[model samples]
Target: MFRATTATIHTLCMLALAGCQPSSDGRDHGQMQLDACVAEACTTLNLDGYGMRDYNAVAGLAHVTSLMVSYTDFADLSELAAMSQLRELHMGMTEVTDLDGLAAFPNLEVLHAQYLEPQSFAPVAGLARLRELAVGSAGLDDLSFVAQMPALHRLLVVNSVQGLDLSPLAGHPGLRALDLRASDGMDLRPLLTLPNLQEVALSRIGEDIDPTQAQVVAQLRARGVSVDLDAIVVPVC
Candidate 1:
């Protein structure tokens, strides 16, 4: 749990320094509302834009388990290094360029990141406890990292870089559900090798697609895995 005393002190100091005053405009704007974040025992932090960049503000919340950050300019997650108990993270439409800070949370289970700049997900592959992963990026091309996540069960990938290869997902021991979208053709044969697959949804973002993709879908259906080609599956946290 968070040290209430520490958070109180920090909050008061921040408030005093900023000289926070009620705006005559009566509109909710500016940086993240710091006082509201600590009201819930500081266990869950939701930062929704407004130029919130000071990650150190929540570093004292040692027990925080779920965090959501969006529409910010911070490129890396280095400031969140102290949140070791974090389990779920929803970071979308942010300036985050790399996932190096993920190493701090060995217990993380669910991760959702989208609309990011080009970057390698090399660090995410090391999360041994991760079960569900949702990522959308035009810059993410190499997916070999998925092979290392033996515990992964559900995966959602959207807007992949053109010509993305999904060979890394073959023969996954525990994967049960998968949702993917691509603007270009990608080999879909890997889905056939997933022994535990139960459901799959594929969305074509462009007209270009492999001719054999229909056959692959049929094969998965024959094997009792539900496949939906026309449906668009969006992952959320």
Candidate 2:
């Protein structure tokens, strides 16, 4: 288990001074954005949309409540353990493996990974306060870790739906949003019984959902649960 030290303060300063450098917002900004990301004192760090080839700024961030690093190639998260105040962390395509760095943020409430095929949540199982989790890929066959998340309310499993088995979610009542990009035909009936699942968004279906499966999703929506039946790709098979 990692603990705070003087180094934590230095890292926090780095994050605060992130804007002292200068850079553009991705879509238009590149390393130039992060390079200019040095500030004096700030809490929320919005590094989203930057093609992050380096993350030296993490060391100087402390007391941060929300940090968005989504849509970048950031791999190293060793500096995260120091941001004890961190609550929301968004990462994408960074090709990360270990999550020990995240264990330090006991206050983490939301964790978003653009693609989960390359990451693991096993290390963060101790995050008792996690309320929302989003993964861009559903490549993993074992998501039992989800059940371990007692405070989880929103979950987004995007990209591939290969080998998905959501049976473990049978009794999950706290989840309010369930977003899936594709599911060969994973029976969503189990979700209907969830007491608090308020919204279900099935976006970007790779193959057409069979009629029976489509009806199952429809039923969940008809039962007063919100559903984003976005362009069902192809008609029901």
Candidate 3:
């Protein structure tokens, strides 16, 4: 009978373990693609359809300008802190819950935050350079953040925010277009205070508009603003 030495057994065990482990090169296909994108300095990166949750590789992409991460499983925006050059970010249909990392991008211009219900929109309050914001179906109720954004001209809030409050939008300096489907009983007096308001498309979610709201709409139209109030149906005589 041949006696196996301890060294021989240890060597055999090591080889077996090495064989069991997956090769690092083939382990992560997404990481490899991301690495290639970073190497090429690709400005636009679309991470949709990857079903990826880990964003560690995204930190290396410093030159990415337009990033579309819809359909991803990422819950936070921390990994994108290094991407300060990002201008347009489309984050629709994602699981992202927090936007604290958005503070890093000071030059962000366009933001499409549709279909995501963030805990708070406070992080966006500091984005002074953000111009276009589309928040359709985001279930946002608070418009206080918009008051701080002086450059915001276009705001789209369709199919969200029941019993909406327009007090926050009062006295907006550059607000030109407003499109929203708000529930009935919303205060429409705030629309009169916007200095540059040029267009409005309001659709009520409930029955006939109140007399006060109708009067407000009439006043807005009287001011040369193109107002479309199809939902404001007065009771038939």
Give the candidate number with the greatest lDDT. 1
Clashes found in each candidate (C-alpha, N, C closer than 3 A)? 0, 25, 0
- Between 2 and 3, whose TM-score is larger? 2
Which is the better candidate, 1 or 3, if ranked by lDDT?
Answer: 1
lDDT of the candidates, in the order given? 0.71, 0.63, 0.70
Could you tell me the TM-score of candidate 2?
Answer: 0.75
| lDDT of residue 63 for candidate 2 | 47
TM-score of each: 0.79, 0.75, 0.71
| Candidate 1 residue-wise lDDT at 217 | 83
lDDT of 2 by residue, 1-237 (tens): 011123254464455335322245553464444334444445666666554545655656564577777655556677565677888887754556667677777898988765545656676667889988766455566568878886888876655556377777878867877876555557677786678888777653245667876787788878798766542321110
Question: Which of 1 and 2 is ahead in TM-score?
Answer: 1
Worst 10 residues of 2 by lDDT: 1-10
Mind giving the per-residue lDDT tens digits that candidate 1 earns over 78-149? 777788889987776667877887888899998877667646778888889999887778778877888999
lDDT of 3 by residue, 74-103 (tens): 667877788788898877656777888889
The candidate that wins on TM-score is 1
By lDDT, rank the candidates, best first. Answer: 1, 3, 2
Candidate 1 lDDT (Cα, whole model)?
0.71
lDDT of 2: 0.63
* Candidates sorted on TM-score, descending: 1, 2, 3
**Clash number for candidate 3:** 0
